[model samples]
Target: MWPAVGLTRSLYLKELYVARSRWRSGVGTVLMRTLFEVAAKHECSRVEWTTDANNPGAQRFYADLAFQQLPSKLFFRADATAIEHGLG
Candidate 1:
């Protein structure tokens, strides 16, 4: 679900999904367009989302909608280095 707020120039799509059998049947397009329209109604000038790096299908889907790939950053935290040294 996407969050709805007062009219703004930015839009964010938290998540979207379609049935596997319905791929390329215009459902995804319609869903995106509808979302865009909703965003536009709220004065949103941009729509954005994130997908897993290994999800080629999702990547292609977003690409078809004119979404350009942007550089990303990831961070991880680890602790207790000795905790796993002797334990399997």
Candidate 2:
């Protein structure tokens, strides 16, 4: 998780992954709950993450945890080469 600049100090979760064999277990829930606990400890305003649209399981998991989908926003990636080229 990376902290955002501002009074609220929001956090952005880069990614979350669990072993395929661990599916249907409570590990994901526990992991998320722990992440929230950490965010609370740091007084973070919110925690954000992104999942591929192709991964319905992940999407459902986040939705079950009350994470709203921001369909209006789009996620972009800038690799090292792209950045080095100053967004060409």
Candidate 3:
């Protein structure tokens, strides 16, 4: 969870992966619902996450769950190894 513009906080879901054996078993939906419940219990204003652009199945899953795409935002990451040595 992170601080937001207002008094509310937001939940950042870094990752959510279900095992291949659990696919099409409604596990993802249940997990997402539980996540939302936990977030609401903690007073989180919203939940933000990212899905691979190449994974259409995952994208469709999120879209089916009513998660909007923040097209304007780009995700960034700093590899732990690279972070120690500054990029050359």
Which candidate wins on lDDT?
A: 3
Per-residue lDDT of model 2, residues 1-88, tens digit only: 3446565777778888899999879899999999899989998988888999899999999889888899897998888988888943
Q: Score residue 58 of candidate 2 by CA lDDT.
A: 96
Q: Is candidate 2 or candidate 3 better by TM-score?
A: 3
TM-score of each: 0.68, 0.84, 0.87
List where candidate 2 sits over 4 angstroms from the true fold: 1-6
Clashes per candidate, residues 3 or more apart or on different chains? 0, 0, 0
Which has the better TM-score: candidate 1, or candidate 2? 2
| Backbone clashes counted, model 1 | 0
lDDT of 3 by residue, 1-88 (tens): 5677587889888899999999889999999999999889999988888988899999999989887788898988889888999988
Candidate 3 C-alpha RMSD relative to the actual structure? 1.8
* Candidate 3 backbone clash number: 0
Least lDDT summed over 10 consecutive residues: which range in candidate 3?
1-10
Candidate no. 3 TM-score: 0.87
Model 1 C-alpha RMSD vs. true structure (Å) is 7.4
What is each predicted model's overall lDDT from 0 to 1?
0.79, 0.86, 0.89
